[model samples]
Target chain A: MSERYLFRGNHAIAEGAMRAGCRFFAGYPITPQNEIPEYFSARMPDYGGVFLQTESEIAAINMLFGASAAGVRAMTTSSSPGISLMQEGISYSCGADLPMVIANVVRGGPGLGNIAPAQSDYFQATRGGGHGDYRTPVLAPNSVQEMFEFPKLAFELAERYRTPVIILADGLLGQMIEPLEYTFDPVDPKTLPKKDYILDGCKGRERRVIRSYDLRPGYLEKLNFERIKKYQKIEAEEVRYETDHLDDAEFVIIAYGTCSRVAKAAVRLARNNGVKMGLLRPITLWPFPKKMIEELTGKTRLFIVVEMSMGQMIEDVELVVKGKAPVRLIPHPGGGIPTAREIWERFQQFREEL
Target chain B: MRKVYHRPEGLTDTLMRYCPGCGHGIIHRIIAELLVELNIRERTVGIAPVGCSVFADEYFNCDMIQPAHGRGPAVATGLKRANPDLIVFSYQGDGDLAAIGTAEIVHAAARNENFTVIFVNNAIYGMTGGQLAPTTLPNMVSTTTPRGRNTKLAGNPIRVCELLNSLDGPVYINRTSVHTPQWVLKTKKAIKRGFEIQMAKKGFALIEVLSMCPTNWRMSPIESSRWIEEVMSKYYELKLFRDLTKEEK
Candidate 1:
């Protein structure tokens, strides 16, 4: 394992996927994340992996569907608008019960908004960006190290659940450079679970058919119920978050990804000024750390929700809070990261109100 | 007991849900028979499109995938790239391949991906109850074109074989039909050849089968076959459009 190497967040994700036994990569070029495909385009061949700069985001995700269906580790990376184009394929993958990784290096958008980092896609990511009764484990990575680590983590979760997993990152995290250490050896594909469902030519066995179209009266209901059970299991086992200085704290600021990193700095400054602020960062946003937040409802008097969107995650926070405590939103809108000083000012306002 | 005929091992015992006298049943049998003959059933993957053949996976005894409408080629590309030893093919209807999946099929051919495509051109959106398709002939009436297809507004039928021939990626590209016993045998042979090319690890291979849609065409099965020969085949002629392997020889 190397101690350190200069890597962009996107490149770290690409390297992590390759080491995680991703044998196929297909993606379309989109901003702040273009380096991911470019890295794979150069490195995959050296490892005997397949890399395709697909014609469109739709094609890329479909390629992932095909590769994953064939019982190989596969992935694709895109930003907000590109991810929207892939929802159909994403839903299809979930229905087909294929395991794969997808990274949304999110940028601002309701449409083709600027390529700057923004958390506006939190709703789209955590709420099944694709259609149907399915949920993808969404992992939010704040540091370049987590960016390197989450892809591998995403693959394991995807394989364990036989479902897709999403690495919900934003542009600033994607474009930023950091020193990363390779702490793991590359995964050996041969050691992966036997995919009896893979389409590997049915010569020595009964033919395996992987499909999602169950048109019978109660067939879909049965399948959807099974999917719900799987989601329930994931919810029970995969809730992840980090707490900072929460012991004896009166005010807590909740955020994730790049915004959480900013909130951490703001909390530090607020604590220096005796404002008693702590930071709670959600690492897995899909199976959100609801219990942790619910625990704070009575213990903490005020909870601050900071984000790069118009109060998207605040809804989830409120659901967990259950009106036990007052909550305020500090929105940074889209296209830019919120400053720590701005967050500290908000903490001051909340402290004065208290 | 000298068995003169029986179902191939590549097919399940389950009866298909296709309409009576549909060409899909015949085509399905052809593919199944060939998979057994080639002994590639276990290592073969088929991508099903979102048309009537979306249920093709139900009939095939091999591993199968049903992708979104018109995205079979892209899915096939991924499968083939992931495991070069696997025999991959996509089964697509006219609307699925020509209308919505144009980019996927075109780029797949352009990439020279080593796989086969079973393109079924029924000239109407069969599964959707006879809507006009990209291959619908001029003056042909469909639900969407109640007054007959107006070439001025709807454009002429696209000749998929000729269109793909313009690309150098495909190692083999052919068009055949299942209207008559003679054409049915020919289409089967073309399909077999397409599979052989795929087994050889040659580039993309496509076999377009001009099929009959009796229910969608508002005619008996017999009339539908006649219509295919007289109308559809006239515009989409049966022939081998390209064979790059031949050029290499």
Candidate 2:
């Protein structure tokens, strides 16, 4: 049975993780995401789950490494600076092939940027932020309802690919209140595929070793090739995006996360003003919906990339567009969301240049 | 004639990878021997630190994980918390635990995380070509400390067991060495006791061994063994710092 309830985005994410059978959660207190661990602390103990407030972000992520290796669903949450502290562990999880979920309630930052909503972490989340030639599947949630839904999907993708998955939510989505419908079924650990490589003891089985270090010649290369193969599989099968008024539109806007919601409103306004504008919201940022951009380049007159950063994802959009269509970027520096009126204004300015 | 001596069931047939006369092989043997004797060989999960002992998973005939540098305890905490019935331990070297990993070990102890930690303090970084470690004694020369280490400049050696003894989280804390046959037996007893405390679900337990690094110490095996007894043991000491089970009794 499904139920609907009022929830803040952070609370919806917490509930969504619990529904996805996260039995262990460890985190440190950070703004915009403190409510995540705070909610788990009150709720996990009642269900015999472990909720730990670690000393630092480093400790929390390492705890996730341990819990996941023990063959249980484990997770951690942090904002920007905290996520920076977690880079080494994140890289380690990738190297060791541990399945875990991380939620970054992104605040503005190059370093201690601000405790406001921002999509500045787009590059850090999409690209491997740590020292590795690897990529984690990044899910960007544009709505409070998506905040409730992406956790389950993140865990599934993580386990399916044997890699870490990130739910990239900005502060606006995390702080805003909305009605969320529970659509996912609570998963049972027993029903999940047996993790034969976990470090849960060697009883009645061959001793298992989970390590990333390979000093031998050509050994690490082989391991990296395997990782690349898995990533290719993910990129092939897991590209997700939402397209609105794309067909027969003269102007198109590419955005994700909070900016997507704003772009949708701007598209509506542009249509009312006799401008043929469409919006494409990428839900899976890493396995980016590049195919859609390729298909739309010939149909649209101009592609406008909207983001709350100094133009990160625009590079990716342009790479796919391949100069078939002229591309322009409307940048919003961190710490606040651009209003629909502001986005509509940008559309008008770009149309004038056209 | 009966076969009087045989390799323990907890060790694989893989040849030892430690440098000649390194203390890691002996320590590995002791852990395997204890695991077999305690009958927890199968239900034991060991986390290998990213140091000289990073390949420890290859030697142990049980489930093992090689965590990133200084992340052994954090990994062990997660493993033990998730699987309460399993016996979990982490094998770490001095640089791996006492230096970059100081925050992790200290907080793990403060939390009273129920697990065992086998800390091998050799006082110098061996795997990365003999750099000065946090446990490196004053005036000790390494690749990094070209001249003798200056306490005023490089900070004094960290007595890990003493530092951790200040924390109230751990149930058993002891420092032992394996310089001689007698000391080997005592170190083994300490390792076994750590596992016993974890089995009792007391709290965190640690057995810090003052191991040897002959190649990096620029000495012969026997000379390094003497150095540990004469120099390392003088400062680190060979004594139990805390024992909650003894207090209860």
Candidate 3:
């Protein structure tokens, strides 16, 4: 049975991590993400776990790396700038196929832009960051309940795929309080599949060397191919999306996270006005519901992409739309989220155009 | 109970590719030989660093992960966290650990990260040619410090063992040299102690071996070892910084 409780998105995440058997947390506190480690630091010791507020994001990631090497569930949370500091470690985790979770509570950015909410890291998170040919599972949580459940799923997915999985949320989602339906139950690690690729110690076992060096051109290529194969599997099986009220709509809006929440408001208003509009939120930004959206080309005549950035994800929308429908971009920058009133105005204007 | 001299199970038949008189060759052998004795080669995950030993991954004949320069500790830490069941170690050079990755290695030790660190202090950059490193001794002349290192401007040489010893988390920190037959034996023992601490799942352990970089030092392997003993050991003292059994909580 699903458990329920009252908590903020950040607390929900902390509760979810605890539920998912994450016993180690190494994070440098930043705006919107400070609560996670703060919560864990106060609670981990009671569970015989560890919570370290590292000197910097770099140290936190490496510390998380060490804990993960021990075959324990470990994680780290940071805002955009801190996440930027951690990208190198994240890429290494990917190259090594290390199972762990990295939460990015995105705030405004380009360069330490602000301490306010923003989805400007869309390109960086969804696409691979750092110097590498690798991709991590990117999960976008839209609500407080998702914040509670995603970590359990994220950890499971990471271990299942033997790769890093990112929980992409914004400052707003991270800080705002809501009634979360978790933090009431504990997750058992024994029920999970056994992970054998850890370095506990060379006692009673052969020396286990975990490395990611494919120097031989042929060998490196083979490793790359294998990674791609795994990515393909993830794309096929892990792509999650939610569609609302578009069965016979003429116009559909593509968004994720907070943007989707606003688009829903617009969808409701436009539907009442006989404007036939709906919402398509992409939860897994990496696998991208391109095929799912593609299948809707017959029904989705006009595509409207709403985002907090300068239309980064719209590119993906256009790629899938394939010019089949006229794709429109509605972007708002700075510290503000797109309000329902503004979205409704835009949706109605686009409604008349179609 | 096991034989003291058999090749470790994880180590392959390929001999290390380090140059003659290279301390890394001896260190690698010692680690592999110890793994064989302990019989845990299959569970050993090595985080390889960039340097003359950048490809140490290939030579180690184990599951190795190549991390960026000075980031081996970070990578090794990640592996250990994700797989607490594995025995993880990072083998790094002075240039990789002390200079480029100064922050990473230092903070890792400071945090008392649970793992083992094999720090080979050769005092000079060997892989990239005869360049002066952070650990280069005073008055030492290399390609960069041709006229000798200016203590006034170039600053004092780094003593890794001393620096690491000052940290709070590590279980053991020892400085050993590979200058002579006797010292080589001692260095091997230090490396084993480090691995043993890691086996205990104790906090961080490190062995900073003052090694000779013959090709980079612009001297014969024998002279390089002599310089290590005469000059390097002077700045870096040989002793245990923290012992797990005595100091662990």
Candidate 4:
């Protein structure tokens, strides 16, 4: 049995990145995620990795761009406001087809809104947060174990797709501590397959160039079309979700991240009270489990979308459901977490009305 | 018969899109020649900034990355720190290095990042048309400053070498021009020295090249070169502000 150790979500993320062979990390300090950079600063040197406390979040993301272009697994962590500052670099990484990982420990936001846990950035993560036409694959981790294990998966998806990957978490998850075990042995970067497109040097080969712009007319359009096909491929292959009693579930609660954990408890409460409620937790928020939701729509009478914000993920749920069933939202905007008892009571009320 | 002149292997065959008599071509040629002369062509990784030299990734015959506007220094720091064996340089324009990316450049210098920076100060935003630049000379006429730059309104031109020379992290900081043939040779020498310092793992080194922008300045090629020597050089003095090698010697 793997030995279990108590770890905070933020520190686990840093440790998981190091174990995943991330040799470069640059990030600015922000609330709920300060421990990430602090942990990396103290531990990375021992692992022969580089850690940089950058001037701003913009510099951190741009640094990731450079490190990723040089064929190194790199990561950066920031909060809501800081993540907003990093959009430009993230868009550039997408345009240039460079691979990198970014973790956004969400806090209440609209502008320095507060350091309380919130899921207001769901729309920004699923849709391309930055300008231009692109989508960054997003992974929503709810548990401390998922926080520790997601960085390795995020890096794999980033390199496999040659695009930026976002690990979307909230302050509640980042601050929570739990016992966790390593899911796999630490990776040795030297043993990894060599990437052909890295810009380490042009020795014994033709020189390579990595750029986002195509000045020639119609060239950028062509590139965009090719990238869209890659997105489609990912949608087909990378959709991931967890189902709880979904087979016989007449009512479903759809949620993710911290809210999903609450919804899971609410589902258990409803089941104990002789209600046929189920929970569907989405892991990959970008290649969202659209097929599973559509399949569930046939058997489900109603869907309750519980979120820490004002109904952001509900839009995706509604789109997938296609108005076949009614969807209701239990929104607690601005750092409010819905209690399991409250959710169960609301479901009972809605059922009584039905 | 011996050939006296040939194209340097450091540059690609892609034709530069710069306007005629533009200083970018001249500066590009100098960097290419130095890359070959130093024999670090294969191991060098150049960063192209978003300005007139945005296409530098195509021109520089080495592994290159074109990052976002004004982010060259941060990118270079990452590349150099991640792999110490790789030779990295960031080629930037005035708007990129001084105006928008000031923090990146200053912090990189403060860290004494072991890399080379080629800052081209043409006194105008060449790529975005004739707008004002951070290094624009006082009372100089630009599109934004049509009636000439007012020192009180627009602020004074930044003396980049002098500003950076005050920092202890930088091992070498020099300002050179590429207008006259003598100054062009001197600019090449200063840039070469900057790369040499990086090769020796000394510290951060910057070579500020006061270049010509004939199209943006709306002047003839000869007049543009003459303007750089007579007018621009007065505000930005052509001299070495800091040289650790010379200090030690």
When just chain B is superposed on the true chain B, each candidate scores a TM-score of: 0.97, 0.98, 0.93, 0.98
Model 4 misplacement above 4 A? none
Query: For residues B172-200, could you state the per-residue lDDT of candidate 2 as single tens digits?
Result: 99999988889899999999999999998
Candidates ranked, most accurate by DockQ first = 2, 4, 1, 3
After superposing candidate 3 on the true structure, give the runs of residues whose Cα lies further than 4 Å from its correct spot.
A1-3, A183-185, A201-207, A349-354, B1-11, B33-46, B55-68, B72-89, B113-115, B138-156, B168-171, B192-204, B237-249
lDDT of 3 at B24: 86
What tens digits encode model 3's per-residue C-alpha lDDT throughout A113-220? 898888988898888877678888899999988988999889989899988899999988988887766534587765666568766555565545555566666997
Model 4 has a DockQ score of: 0.88
Q: Which ten residues in a row have the lowest lDDT in candidate 3 chain B?
A: B6-15
lDDT of 2: 0.90
Please, what are the lDDT tens digits per residue for candidate 1 over residues B1-249? 899998888888988889887899899999999998988888888888888998898888888888899999999998888888999989999999998999999999999999999999999998889999999989999998999999998888888889998997889999999989998899889989999999998879999998888888888999988888787788898898888888889
Quote each prediction's TM-score. 0.98, 0.98, 0.89, 0.99
TM-score ranking, best first: 4, 2, 1, 3
Per-residue alpha-carbon lDDT of model 2 for A111-156, expressed as tens digits? Answer: 9999998888888989988998899999999888998888889988
Model 3 over residues B101-216: C-alpha lDDT tens digits? 88888877877767788899888898888788998988999898999999898888887777777776777888887788898899788878887777878778888888888887
iRMS per model in Å = 1.0, 0.8, 3.9, 0.6
> Which of the two, 1 or 3, has more DockQ?
1
Better of 1 and 3 by TM-score: 1
TM-score preference between candidates 2 and 3, better one: 2
Query: What DockQ, on C-alphas, does every prediction get?
Result: 0.84, 0.88, 0.44, 0.88
